[model samples]
Target: MMLYIIDSIRTNNFHGEQMMGKIRTLWENASRKLEHHQNNVYGVYNDYESDYRGDYSLSIAMEENNGEAFIEITSSEKYKVFQVDKTDEQGMFKTWSKIWKQEEIGLLERAYTYDFEKYGPNGEIEIHIGAV
Candidate 1:
């Protein structure tokens, strides 16, 4: 089994609408064998801060002759893409908003291969977000 944790920072549509909506494209890999779903973060807010943090933790149970699964994280806004490696045992990929230079809100991600012996308990990855 493999798990992909996608974290989306404070996001809003052009009309300034504030809500957490699932982006279908990101789950393209598991579309065929998607066994179950667990939406960790949905319809949330952070009025106290300038940004919001939301995550979609999808779990894919292994099947017979399965190759591999992938995790894709994207934003409707324009921003750059930076690489934030995992710095702790949590395997968190951190992102910053201010660094984005394009129309896309930057994405920082890290992936782990499932090795039950090494990674243990169905490879799980964490993502961390911060202000730009």
Candidate 2:
């Protein structure tokens, strides 16, 4: 089974923080109704045209690894890669494992966060939140 996934990224610093916070608020607001159990994928990518808030567009995948979640970020750019895995007891379901790692300037960081959704069967909707 494949799930529709929406991915997002956040940068460090005040401006990035503000954008991240706003993105989180948007997710929480919609999550109340968007929550599902059909299993969906999640990932992030740099929007070369993201000058405006809507410039960053989220992607939806219909075919992918089952219960697998992937997340990646490209250097010098906002490109990110992610996969969602719900079958493993330690991937998405486990918060610790779901978290990715990052290190910059000799400091450890979790560059981005990934999550999954399974909203009813055949549920199709446009991704509204996620920007970096």
Candidate 3:
């Protein structure tokens, strides 16, 4: 499906540049730019130049285009889903840490196409990693 992205950035996990700070700012700006009415919002990783270690773009998006920038992300047949409790402030990062660890050890064969985080309406979360 296609996602209407509120904001976007190109960054990589390597290189001294911080992903969290940039992502936080992107979401901050996006929240101010549009009126969100979706049951869930998505953090979509796309435009992959290579694998997870390579540069990619992250967008805060929803189902409707609403004249905003958008990207197409489809659900794959195989995935690794990580659930995060809404109350844990660091749950998001911790889940990502676990994902990276698995990828580092050859546990995750990534698709390098689209990975997304679903922020549920009830405040729960699921990090979906595309698998090859």
Candidate 4:
């Protein structure tokens, strides 16, 4: 899949609950002035300062020929996909945190590249972790 996204930088160090709050706020603001062409939105992290902090960029889906300014992202390679159901009261980020804490399974994240979240229409979330 391909995405045409509006970019922003998130530099806060908040983790867990605090991070989720910030993420909601960020998505609200990022999408406020934009139009949604698809049911799924994406949050792409291109630069990682550490495990839980980085320059986070949010983007809504758009057509390839849409005459708007956007960063184009294409899912051309294999990535590890993690799902968060809409029915889960704890939400996507919290579920991600829990997954991140499980290091014994040996699923190493490719932090050098971009990682992203695909938010579905039914509120389901598919987190694509860049993997080596």
Using lDDT, give the best candidate's number: 3
Model 3 misplacement above 4 A: 16-18, 34-38, 75-77
- Give per-residue CA lDDT, model 1, range 1-132, as digits (tens): 233332223333233233224323433544444444333321111222222232223233332234354333334323223333345442221232332222144443222111111111233332223223
Write one digit per residue (lDDT tens) for candidate 3, span 1-132.
Answer: 778877788988776288778978998887775455656788898888887778898888887766357777655457789998668888887888899899999999888778899887777899999888
lDDT of each: 0.29, 0.36, 0.81, 0.61
Model 2: residues >4 Å from true position, as ranges? 1-14, 48-132
**Residues 1-132, model 2: lDDT tens digits:** 333333334443234547657666646644553455354433333342432222343333333442244334223333222333445554432422233222223223322322223232544322221224
Greater-TM-score candidate between 1 and 2: 2
Candidate 4 lDDT by residue in tens digits, 26-104: 6677666445545567777665665555444444443444425555455665577787866778777576775576533
User: What TM-score would each prediction reach against the true structure?
Assistant: 0.20, 0.29, 0.85, 0.68
Winner of 1 and 2 under lDDT: 2
Let me know the TM-score candidate 3 reaches against the reference structure: 0.85
Candidate that scores best on TM-score: 3
* TM-score-best of 1 and 4: 4
What is the alpha-carbon lDDT of model 1 when measured against the actual structure?
0.29
